[model samples]
Target: MELLKAQNIEKKFVNHLALDDVNVSIPENSIYGLLGPNGAGKTTLIRIINRITAPDKGEILLKGRPLQPEDVNIIGYLPEERGLYKKMKVGEQALYLARLKGLSKRDALKRLKYWFGKFEMEAWWDKKVEELSKGMAQKVQFVTTILHEPELLIFDEPFSGFDPINANMLKQEIIDLKKKGATIIFSTHNMASVEELCDHITLINQSRNILEGHIDDIRKKYKSNIYEISFNGEVEKLEKSLNQYYEIIDKTKVDGHSAVRIKLLHQTNENELLSLIIPAVEIISFKELIPSMNDIFIKVVNEYKN
Candidate 1:
């Protein structure tokens, strides 16, 4: 079911349009990637949903009802701009934020202890926020964001200062959250993370939503129909073998064997491709080349700019 939806959301700032006729629906218990290059109105739209700012025109619905101010309490937001009081002790700060989200003192402490232990930050609870590294501070912030177990979690540039190991750890935790029935809205410029974690994505460019859909569906829609073929044979035989049916786009040697990449024209089928190559070379493997999210991101953004 759609947990949240924005319909024709429009927002403007004095002389510039921040969002223009934007619409997107986020499914429950799924990770939705809110992607765009810097200043594409992604942040503007997020603020609208979070009710930090109001849309100039359009409506936001949470669970099919007009979103109200109190809905903010049900949302866990980790903004791209992290904010933690520098002088506040880590544990003390976390407890305060949790209470602000409507948790009682007892419940907030109970949840904070669990999260601190889970994230292995229990030992650092007494340290001041300024004493922690950027990544360390982000970890504490993440714990507080999820401490109340909100129905929807919005994370912006979640891995910005994280090292590879810590980043992967956070990714795993996100996946685990989904498994435990949390809907997530993740905003980032990192295409790799989108590829790995997002089930669906909406790509915004120049304050306009340029693309939106399930990851697999979008990838398939943008497919180039390139195929990679590996065979155990002399290069000459493989070259001559491909002459009959498929058009060889490129050929390379990999691990003492010849590999040929081909793009089929009309009337060319996989069976036809295999039929021509099987006789001339020992077929090792054949697979289609799926475009990566990074490739799709560049292609879509460039198209929109032009």
Candidate 2:
């Protein structure tokens, strides 16, 4: 089931079209990546989704129905720009935010304590927000973002301030959230994180959605029929065997094993490749090379610019 769907979402500023007929569907219990280059309208679309701004010409649907003002209570958002009051005590501010989300004081305190403990932040309870490090403060905001147990959570650059240890800790928690059925819309410039965590994604470019699909499917769609073959044989024989069917991209020896990367110049199956090369070299390993998200991002954005 789709927890949220924004169809034909359009937004504009005096002289700028921030979003143009953008459409996104976020499935229940899945992490959706809201991706694009800077100024490509990712945050504009995010603002629309969070009701921070109304679309100029589109509607948002939540849980298969028209989105309502009250739906904000059920949707948690942690913007890239953090807004915690520096002078407020960490635990006090957390409880305040939880109550604003409509939690009772008793319930808010209970949940806040639990999360503080889970994050090993109980010692910082009485400390002012300004007293903690940026990463520690982000941890508090993270706790508040999820304290309500919102059904849909939107996080923009949530990993910004953390070290690898805390970042990985947060990543695992996000995966855990999915397992427990919370739909998430994650926006970031980190393509590697998207490759690791996103089940589906929408790539926006020039105020438009240029790519949208399951992560695996999108990667396959952009595949270039490249493969890396590891073998032990004379490089000269391997080169002769490639002929016109292959384009050797890079050849290097890995820990004494000969590895060669080749791009298929013509449409050919793995069997055909093996048949052509088996007689020339001893095959130790073979694997197709799928273009990484980083490569795909550059390709798509550059093409759009051109």
**What is the Cα-based lDDT of residue 101 in candidate 1?**
93
lDDT per residue, candidate 2, 90-156, as tens digits?
A: 9899999999888999999999889888999999999999999989999999999999999999999
TM-score of 2: 0.96
Which 10 successive residues of model 1 have the least lDDT summed? Answer: 238-247
Weakest lDDT window of 10 consecutive positions for candidate 2: 265-274
Q: Give the TM-score of candidate 1.
A: 0.96
Kindly list the per-residue Cα lDDT of model 1 for residues 184-229, writing each as its tens digit: 9999998988999999999998988989999999999998878999
Off by over 4 Å in 2: none
